[model samples]
Target chain A: MATSHTTEAVNLPSAVQERQRRAKFRRNMFYLALLAVGLVAPFVAYPVFLMKILCFALFACAFNLLLGYAGLLSFGHAAFLATGGYVTGYLLASYPGLTPELGILAGTAMATLLGALFGVLSIRRQGIYFAMVTLALAQLMFFVFVQSSFTGGEDGLHGVPRGSLFGVIDISSNLAMYYFVFAVFVFGFAVIQRTVHSPFGQVLKAIRENEPRAISLGYNVDAYKLLAFVLSAALAGLAGSTKTVVFQLASLTDAHWHMSGEVILMTLLGGVGTLLGPLMGAGLVVSLQHLLAQSPLGNWVSVILGIIFVVCVLSFRSGIIGELSKMYRKNFK
Target chain B: MTMIFGVPMAVFMGQLTLGLVNGAFYALLSLGLAVIFGLLKIVNFAHGAQYMLGAFAALLGFRYLGINYWLALILVPLVVGGFGMLMERFLLRRIAHLDHLYGLLLTFGLALIFEGTLINFFGVSGARYATPEILQGGLNLGFMFLPTYRAWVLVAALAMCLFTWFMIERTRLGAYLRAGTENSQLMQAFGVNVPLLITLTYGFGVGLAAFAGVLAAPLYPVSPTMGSSLLIVVFAVVVIGGMGSILGAILTGLGMGIIEGLTKVYYPEASNTVIFLVMILVLMLRPAGLFGKEA
Candidate 1:
């Protein structure tokens, strides 16, 4: 059933393929326009809020790299996020001489190691078991952080310095930090885009569609899955590290399972497989939270998100961008 | 005080009894999970929420309707079970043909909704549910004093788990349920109402969770977020036991709980994480779970 869908994509008619090529060009243009808007967005909207949206957008995109492309639903992604945040936060707080870039890199490294370990343990199971295993492992991490002195127990690591970028440009300024975040986000997004179009991604897709067939075709499916999981984890870590710098705090909330669910909500809401879907989803969710924070309805955010989840699973599984593209294809064709 | 492995006997016995009580809960919750998964082919993530609802239902019954403990015990499950049936009819049935993961996600969302709504009303601090007048006191068990309420919980949960095992494993209806699990289309060919059976099965599974919840209310403060954290542990327990065998789920749950309790006595720091550590070891050694048939 999965193979047929991928095969259909591969075996498209030349005329239709040409149309798809044109659509891709149009989509690229749309992305460029969106980036332009984002660059100028801080002038009108709160830069801090915009930064929050970008951090989450990158996180969700990293998550989508697994769930959308590789068909792996990891329910423990918050572990990587938290690991990155805590490592970065601890380094910047204790070692005042450490550069922000190094701290971020260090955080990402920790997340990569964690990802590699968790991915190796969890990749043995398929489907629901995989999700449960990741969750259990993440919960273990959560407890470790809670009980440890470094994480400050329930209060988390606070007052993490933004520090200088490469020992020259001071990133303590909000604008500098915002632009720094923007650069990191762009880099992360580019990496995801490049990874998706690479030869390795095709193999990952093959594994996702039909592991048995991929194995028959001489592909080591587990290796591919592990690699994808690690990549997803590292990028998610990058997002977490960037978020710590942006907010200047690394709290327990970042590593909580609810954060993992929030990222899933963003990815699922935006469009699971589409490149721009997670960005849109992150923006919408962040905005929803922002708006709701001022109203009595703030407490209802989970319920609302829950309703959205049910609605999405029931009838809108294709998501916003997925549905839009479908309509565009129908109308254009 | 006598010592066992250099630990005081009272501490050892206390932890052991506590472990057994916790084991009872794990067995009960995981059993319900296994049953639902056995027939429905969907992991009911909302099982924890249903358990929470069972506790809340009892609390509400007392606060508003003045219903006592014994009556609440009987009524709560029926109410929660009816809600589960409605969920199956409206939400679950629609996605019955999709991938099993969708069911997991759907129920996950449902759980969030239930938990969140409850939080909005009750707040996060949790409400108290007093132990019944009959089960208020403690028993001097010689080695260690045992709270009568906790002992009742252990016994009641064990009885419920055993009864459920017997009903599913030995009865004629259980045979049909098992047959349907193996091949629903074949069972339907024999004039069984597979759809109704599926709904009732889900309801029954949810009802069992609620039954556990009612038992837990007086032991712990009734709260909305209570189920979520406990749910993760139970998920680990379910994974360790494997979802395929009913007896496996029961044994694994009880065993893991004892292990956790023992950890508290021996290595207090590792108590929270021993189950997950065990899960990692189990995954490495037996990827399919201790009792599970290979997929």
Candidate 2:
């Protein structure tokens, strides 16, 4: 009797089933296209530049995963970024005979661990309280890094070598390094996309839209939040580790609370929930900085960035990709 | 004549006095933050920049107008408060209906603009503003040497905090302000000028920061970077004390300041971060903060 009931449930109208299947395939194709672009774009851009973009894109994406999807704003994301950067820099620069791969892993591991620790303490509060808790925790980490001898105290850890990737590939070459970063970014991006589309992601969205309803449905809301937080932190660490490798140095700037604000700005500038938004946002921000390097307006970057944040928050809540997606959806539908 | 807890009495007294001086600024700044946050529901990230602006205003007054310390104390807050009013009128008023986070983002933008402008005009090395000759000397406390200016600062800040507290917590006008803070719509129905009150509340809060700036000018070297450094510490203060009650803000500020000073005497390395450490401990024990209400 149970088997017959299950079979009946599975047997749906063919047209409705076909539409669902086509939608699933389209989403998968979108992911594949994104992966392909992330992989190929490095060759077109400067390798180092590409690496920077990937790392920040990953960071912004991780940040959006929390704020956009989970409906939590974390003001202290630099804690994870700094932890990852410090771990990688310390290992590559201080320890002898460490491969780049191992260094990256070490950084990612530290960030993951720290993220879990913070997530437990932070998820207790909602909205503004959550933001404040994160900021306070991150500020604590900043002080620790500033005072610790290993971080080189204010002067920062300098002269880090771009060690060989697993003692084989020389990451010194621009093209070679680009491909390595591209591969890592794609891996991270794919994981995020998968996680977001899974049953877990659906639960997260439900919680974001209306927590009481999600709770009423017998979901362990807090646990879902914690899981999302850890994932976001680990991805952010990946970005930070990649950045350390690309820059060949780790400094106080990486750990400074201002960097946390900058990441939020990047996520906001890009459409928050859109997959392509962070990538485009990262590209825009990084390229802006690159251009600003030669111009007199260089000093005003923070001001301009801040203005963009205010404007985006006030007027363009959906962000660039979000707006674009709306047009696309209207036309296609 | 004797030592207590194996520490010299003179040294202990000195630390206590120093703690009081630091506490004065803490109380003043946190009070301003609480007022601003209470009414606006925004943290005002640019507060530090405005505090710095207050110091700069004093410095400018001294440089060009030959204004003395006392005159600047009165004039600067008015000036800074007026500037704050203008900011509210032009920028902040436009985004009041949106999420409060927009306020933070906008203020953050203004902070960058102000800081960047100051940096462009006056280099990052920082400039100095000297204490006026009248308040230059120290007082003989018998147990410890107390600078007259420092003592004055403590007393002045205490008075100002209390006066502001009394104004907001006691008076009829304060009741209206409190009512507006609680429910602007209800207050509007009662025929209160809610929007005007908001602009003034913001001005009053910014003016409080400027007032602290005047108090701080004599103790710390006047610099553009001063406010940001102090602002972060004040944020930690707000987190620990919780912005729930004005009394809580004042007490926690003073208490944390003393704790920080004592830490300096024992373990100087942790002194810089003891407030943050205490904040973490507070979060662990009581996430609602010592006096904050659950949102």
lDDT of 2 by residue, A93-157 (tens): 98869999999999999999999999998887777667877887888889899999988888887
Each model's total of backbone clashes: 0, 0
Tell how far residue A134 is off in model 1, in angstroms.
0.7
Question: Model 2 off-target regions past 4 Å?
Answer: A1-27, A330-332, B1-4
CAPRI rating of model 2: medium
Highest lDDT, which number?
A: 1
What local lDDT score does residue B155 receive in model 1, on the 0 to 100 scale? 88
- How does candidate 1 fare on TM-score? 0.96
Local accuracy of candidate 1 as per-residue lDDT tens digits, B1-295: 8899999988898899899888888999999988888888888989989999999999999999999999988899899999999999999999999888889989989998999999999998989998999999899878788889988998899899888889888998888899998999999999999999999989999999999999999988899998988889999998898988888988998999999999999999999999999999999999989998966
At residue A128, give the lDDT of candidate 1.
88
Candidate 1 docking quality: incorrect, acceptable, medium or high: high
- Which portions of model 1 show Cα errors greater than 4 Å? A1-24
